[model samples]
Target: MRAKHNVLLVTNDHVSTLTGMADNTITVSALDRTKVKINGQEGVGRDLSLHAVATGKEYVHETSKDDLWFFFDVEVASNPALAGVAGFTTFVMILFIISYWNSAGSSTALVLVALQILCFFCINPYLIALSDWRNFMTEEAEALMHSSVGMNKALKSVLTLIVLLTISIFAFLMLKSVLPDRSIQDMGDWELWVAMLFDSASLTLPFICFGLYTSLPLQVVQILASFPFLFMIFFSTTFSPGAGLEGVKGLRFLFARFYLWCVIPGVMEGMEDCPKDNLTLYTVLSGCLGLFLFLGLQGVLYVVEMNKANAAAADFKALQGSDEFKQLQVEMKYVHTDGTPRGFGQTGVDYKDGYEATATEDSTITVSGGAEPPANEL
Candidate 1:
């Protein structure tokens, strides 16, 4: 067989061309031919010919090593999607750095910033990966991938939460150490930081759970995921002077920031003189409230999906019993075994008199002499 050359070069430069050709050159030589006689004419060629060819095994060797190396080292390194996420994370970190410098050594603002970072890290991935989860469900059966769809979703969510939380904590500590006028030592006791981290995660849990379990579209889900942050910024007393106002205090539970604010003492203005007993009570209540919201939202989503499924099934059953479906079945019965209408050549039945059924673009079956099927069926 004639040999073919397939060269892989890193660039079109002369250096790359020489390097590629030197290692991947192939040589072929024609063999001597003998005279052969055809049916009507004689030809000066051998019945069978052979040629010597070089293996050029180095061509495959060079390609195997260099192609993959270039793909992963160069192509993947330059991918915009990966760069976008990293750039966004860096931008957010820059904002936090600015906040660190401007907060006037107030740990409350820093902790709030940390919680915002935690929430962003946790929910951003959910928004980005929702389409992937949907695609996976569409392409594979639930039984093959996990015990159930909910279990698979929960597993993914839990793993992502752990990873993002670890990363956020590490980033926080690193920033605290390297930034001017800030050090981990001045961030207060380790136990307080630990408790703050726990409460922050608790505050973030319900939003994460909502993103995971809700059946809403991606845009709507994202808007809902952002509601807590917006509410905290504009409606809560986190950065405002209403912390001790009677009306604001009464409605504090409605805002997630209030729970977090209560967890850290002296964070709220006018509340520094408040009793520690009340702050401790709010701390305990925050944990309980987080758990309650998390589970309650998941349960509500499950019920909503179940109700949707039941309504769809009921509609399908109603469609099955409808007169249009009966007419379709009757018309189908007159078809011959070979799929031709029995009325076409039958002696007694006239095909013209028979009902003609055509399915519309919306998939509703219609008969020539009857009203169009209802759009609400299924």
Candidate 2:
């Protein structure tokens, strides 16, 4: 009677016995941090962001991937206030520069195209010697002069730039040949994607120009400098006019306003004055903004690091002037074991093993000491 009142709980399972068809699947994959060498990786990282590499540097904090488009991949120590102000100002100025080019007529673009071509062919190798920026190259190049490191870096940079320019030139031509006449503008996936590529080059150009100047390891530079575009690549999922990530309309308009201002806000501000149909608007606009930011940080890092190098040099010079080396002081001076006397200022120290040397008034160099008797010998 008590057993009949026992409670029962039921869970879903095979009662009569049923076998569910399944595939035994296993997945395995692996990834590791890629080795990268920048001009002082930590230094470059610090310049790019305000974060400290040290565990305990006070009053400095890093701003990581907070911005929509800006990022510093490495941890770098810098004054937080200075970094904030510089980054903000540079970002604003970039917008303005893009605005200027957005309205510039086809003539300006034509001139730039020609100049870039000239830079690739005629002026690329001599690039490292032509300006103050190239000064960074001097230290490293001097360190590895005539060695494989320098030669390999040089070849890599040249080849990479050639490839970039080829892609740029080809993109330029594709846009020029495909666009409609300049009355009313219509943009589609082809135009948008091409323009994005064209504009994305802006981010890479400064790294190429200055990085080559320093002959930093180009293999890493090639990979890292490509990141800006690579990051924005999600925007290129499609080439259609309506293609873009979902967002507020107001935000889109605001961005469009900025883009037009950069792409072709027409000095006056109308669709006609706007970027309209010009693709290089996309190119010059983003590129110029990227150039501004790069230049700002580059200028800062160059001056700061250079000052450090100079300060270190000065400290070394001061150390060399210390009194320890006044007369090249010796650890031990030699005198005859039999207590023979030699006049002061007459002893000459010889570097020979097992002997101390002295010069007599005859000007003949002589060894004045004998080797200790060996306890064990051949």
Candidate 3:
């Protein structure tokens, strides 16, 4: 009897399987000769002939499978959703500023522009991380299973910072073009802008970490992601200076938007009627502490998720080795090479005229041979 067995070639090293048919002559064929070995000898062409000893054992060798996660691109530049959202928000803010240009004071308008930009950067990472968590975690988890290096969080963060910096420069140019000369002068130097951009990008990391830490449903994720933006709009120092949570020094230290409001106005001392009394070294250190606290909490959450994913992967591997699964796989013969059920001509039915015959469940079907029947045959 001719029997076929499937083995997982996880590594390049030789692996031996016992056939339990003593002293039998065996012939092995590979899709490629140079890439495979049989019984300690490389194939002569596509086939390798071997004599099994009384032990009924044979060895096969193949190259290692490439780690799928290594090729996954997690850098923010590859994600159009993030860039598109940022661009749209920037455009809308610019329009708002232009519409109110005649009524609002230039300093307040400039501050408003800065706050809007800061809010975009602050809220963006959470949404993106939540939406793309599966992609991120899948690659990382698989890479861990394969004992290979996965996506590096530090590397991704650095790339994200670079993209944010680029966007910040473009935003600055647009804001400069719109603002009056006096307001531009009061906006401080390039150093201040760079510092603010760095802080904004750093602020995004905690949000990203928090998003990845949660495994909620999509609706819940969206709701949770929107909370930060809503909080900024309603409570933070984004709008009226005298109203809504600005008096709460603890909030100013905890949230990035409030922290920016407290710090940036102080740094730009030239701007009249701008709040500057809150920007102290101690306040800056407090903001940093808040960021670190979030980072630590999210780090713990990530480790928990990683452990869960690893355990799930182990269970799946065990299930793959079960005899029931193997039996089911064998009974389902009319499947494509990739193991999907053939969609067309898969019911072993015959029709008249243009209709084609289909294979039975006991038979196999190739993709090219499984053409759809005529439309009239339905």
Candidate 4:
């Protein structure tokens, strides 16, 4: 007779199930040097492999969901240290200038308000870019997860929500300081709040319209700059196994299959074109590209305005007070140095001739004196 036994073994790499004859003993090794798995995928693990065979990077490692975010979304906004300083300092200085000037009854406060308004407007186009990119990334993340090769969609959604919330907070605080008392009251109304949503959209028009006014000629230049890079991303993803298996195909196909259905018709309507799918994508890309130009142009203009205001303020301060300038006079008074009555002069004549006569020598003096005494007596 024979007894039966079963064994279950689990390890980091694999699971094993074994059945043996009754009363049989088997030896199993815990750490097997002969076998290893490369990140849950079969094969493709070696210690002493040639450079040519192993030198190339894995597509999964090099081009993936997180890598896309790193390159397209996060890298530009990274270096949080610098970004933090820029955001905080600009916000603080603008707020301080607006508040301090207004409180001190300075007429320049209105200019400060105007600058703040410009800044408020300038940030909108950036917000549009950020929001569109967020939507794009969210879609890509969804595609990856749908293909069952990425992180959970819930995490991505949560992260995107957090990013949007942070942006909203920054924008709110930035614009709040510039609102007048009456504007604050109006903002408290629900109807006004509803109106604000549309108003906000129109506010972004300044950024775009200003750009159109200033740099219409640069339209082609801007599009050309983004074309090659866009081509690379479109080509790489289109040909990629991950993208193909996920059925994204290429940029146009991916848009046609996915985004076109969602955003295209509205874009076409905005462009006042027929609902044909051919022109939909061009309309969408053109709108996005136009927004990029708008941001760059308005950003440059706003900076120039601030610089002009700063220079004018400096010049005003330089000329405000100086000893070389004096008030006008209505009357004049004269003063004398030496107290002379009007203008006067004095003159003196020669010495007195009849006052004294010289005496003669000593010997002749006696006779001469006697004669002079007689003559004087006579």
Candidates in order, TM-scores: namely 0.46, 0.33, 0.46, 0.23
Tens-place lDDT per residue, model 1, 100-187, is 5544444555655564665466446545655455445534533232134544455556655664555457555545543434433443
Residue-level lDDT tens digits of model 4 in 319-368: 32321111100000011223212111110011111222224211111233
lDDT of 2: 0.37
In terms of lDDT, the poorest run of 10 residues in model 4 is 326-335
Model 3 quality (TM-score): 0.46
Clashing pairs in 2: 46-76, 51-76, 189-239, 202-287, 264-274, 264-275, 266-273
Report the C-alpha lDDT of model 2 over 239-260, residue by residue, as the tens digit: 1223454652222221222242
C-alpha positional error of residue 261 in candidate 1 after TM-score superposition, expressed in Å: 3.7
The lDDT for every candidate, in the order shown, is 0.47, 0.37, 0.46, 0.34
Candidate 4, after superposition: displacement of residue 287 in Å?
14
**In model 1, what is the error at residue 146, expressed in angstroms?**
7.8
Question: What's the count of clashing pairs in each model shown?
Answer: 0, 7, 0, 1
Instruction: At residue 242, give the lDDT of candidate 4.
Output: 35
For model 1, the run of ten residues with the poorest summed lDDT: 47-56
Model 2 residue runs over 4 Å out of place are: 1-162, 172-200, 206-223, 230-285, 329-378
